[model samples]
Target: MARLRRRPRDPEGRMTLSEHLREFRRRLFIAAAAVIVGAVVAGFYYSEIFDLLTDPFYEYARNNPQVDASINFAEATAALSNLISLSIFVGIIGSSPVWLYQIWAFIVPGLTRKEKRISLAFLGATIPLFLLGCGLAYAILPQSLSILYGLSPSGTSNIQQASMYFSFVTRFILVFGIGFLFPVVLVGLNAIGAMPAARLIKGWRIAVVLIFVFAAVATPTADPFTMFVFALPLTALYFGAWLVCRRLDKRKAANRPDWLDVDDTEASQL
Candidate 1:
């Protein structure tokens, strides 16, 4: 039987289990440190994220003549709280690369060569999916705001509190961000062999149902338009993932080692 290649450090040595705990601790510390630094930097730019988010409302208010357009914050403390919250959110998101890298590095020692390659592909696709969702949310914010604003009564339709406005936008961005990653998750499942490309293609009808179900469950707004907007991108992404999986599966079959196929299948099925 042919043997898998070993790294210099490994010298064909397998992990002793105790080393796994030590590595986990080291990666955790690095991830935590990165989070703290990102939080501080994002806190410094808190006003920017705030304004960047709230700019649509400001624009709509400034241009509109009939609605007496302005957001009214009821409490002084709300603004401060919003800043702190926004900073923390930005920090975590901004630090994702650092934390993600730390985690990948820590786990690399335990992974086989093929697993390492799939992990790298997953990391590559993750950023784009997340960004796609965030951009979609930003693009749709104006429409959402218009709908929300138009529903007001005769004389009293101002945003009475910053909390209300922030809550609305933040929820939209977050929901969209997570929702966009649906395709990536599906691709990862295929890469890991828990799901096969052929089976997923066969189950497209059920998959469509699941897509809507995810959109409905994940979306914070009950508005059908907003919910549909979220679902549509995910649907497109799902199809794109199928293409990627098809190519990847063909490559895997072409490159698969026959010796590992038999026993490994039984182990995995177990």
Candidate 2:
């Protein structure tokens, strides 16, 4: 195989079509196998998982009463589908490490020593941030559900289909996970000094608006309580990111000075 030399910082390094295909297949197999293993393991606990998943609906059902009666045709199909989906979801989560490693390994060889260190640090920070986000989502899910359910008027609000519920739950986890990583991205930028704290502070107004907007949109729940809860944490993380970036920039400005300045993203470009 001809060694393809390219810049690691850019999204596009150099890779042949074959290389891409090969990597895709490799990642796919590993991901699939991991999911299968996870699903099998989870199969034993499927009933328990279903019960847990249905809790929010159950809560709503208990309170509303009519919601249970409103559900019928699609509900049964959705129930099984959702269980399967949840199993797949867990499998993917369990297998994430394998894929992460595969990705890291793919790029590691191409990276400089400096680049490798940066990549490792990013990986380290990212994994924890994502996990924290997922954990937070799980903790807040019941609350979010309650809040969403609370918004709807007392009617026959049948949340029948399991698929719909699963989608909502999985999406919640994903959005939270990605949202949590927002600060990490910003923090990484600050570490290298790409984003100045002063600028971030200046942009607070816009940032706050954006946070709320994101809360409004990203949230499938679309309930104010849920939106605010999600947005509040992200807003806090944003400031936290700013503070972190500020300190790093200050240190960078004081110490070794270069055209690179304190731009974190540029620094990470190895």
Candidate 3:
């Protein structure tokens, strides 16, 4: 007779150091594969994506004939390099859900089955928030480009290197997307018992200040409107996360065993 195969083990059990490393390696490989697959897909739509990225600059130039703004390739291989770089960036962003899940799974091996399922649901929320942030950044991109270009003297040629422009655009989008994920992080911390809602509520003043600072940096334009717009959603999300955490805390307290909460110094009446 053939030998019976071992049953699948839960990831939460105690493991040797090497086992942990192997698990990490496996997750990393899967995440990398997802990114590669996404990059391959992006390669097929390179032209459309390229045009979409560069359209803002072209539009600005078209609307203002006085400003001689043009994107130029400084090196012989600049175009090819930019294409590869752009593809990799798009891959990283498009496959973020996979990589992000891998990261979460690696750190959360101690989570209970119920907790894992709840956390997975939160992970699903990350994608939409990230994409929403990217969309908002893209919507405001034209104004940012205009603000930067307007600094140059009238009738002067503003020649921008292609690589630099793409780098700026991609970085801007990535930063905004990451910013929108802050609430999810807070909720995750609460879910893991690392942070409580009361603490978050207490630090609201400081958090608001930091959020404003982040919004200012994220929004390239000096105007207050853009900063407020960026900060508002984040502020709302922070409060939302706090509310969720408060509810979770209540549920956790209700489920706790009464004897566990008794004073350690005092004997329990048996």
Question: Best by lDDT, which number?
Answer: 3
- TM-score, per-candidate, Cα-based: 0.84, 0.75, 0.86
Ranking by lDDT: 3, 1, 2
For each candidate, what is the lDDT?
Answer: 0.80, 0.75, 0.87
Candidate 1 residue 88 Cα shift, in angstroms, is: 0.7
Which portions of model 2 show Cα errors greater than 4 Å? 1-28, 63-80, 151-159, 191-193, 254-270
State the lDDT of candidate 3 residue by residue for 68-118, as single tens digits: 789999999998898888889999999998998998788667678888787
Model 2 error, position 224 (Å): 1.1
Q: Write the per-residue lDDT of candidate 2 for residues 1-270, one digit (tens) a residue.
A: 999885344343557777778767887787677779988787778888777766766665677655542333374476567667788877777666776777777777567776678667777777778888888887788777767666666654655555666777889888888888888788767655577789899999999899999888987777687788888999998998888778877776788646555476555433
Report the Cα lDDT for residue 168, model 1.
72
Model 1 scores a C-alpha lDDT of 0.80
lDDT of 1 by residue, 60-124 (tens): 77667677776666777877887777777787778888887887787777788878898988887
C-alpha RMSD between model 3 and the true structure: 2.9
Per-residue lDDT, model 1, residue 184, is 84
Residue 143 error, candidate 2, Å: 3.4
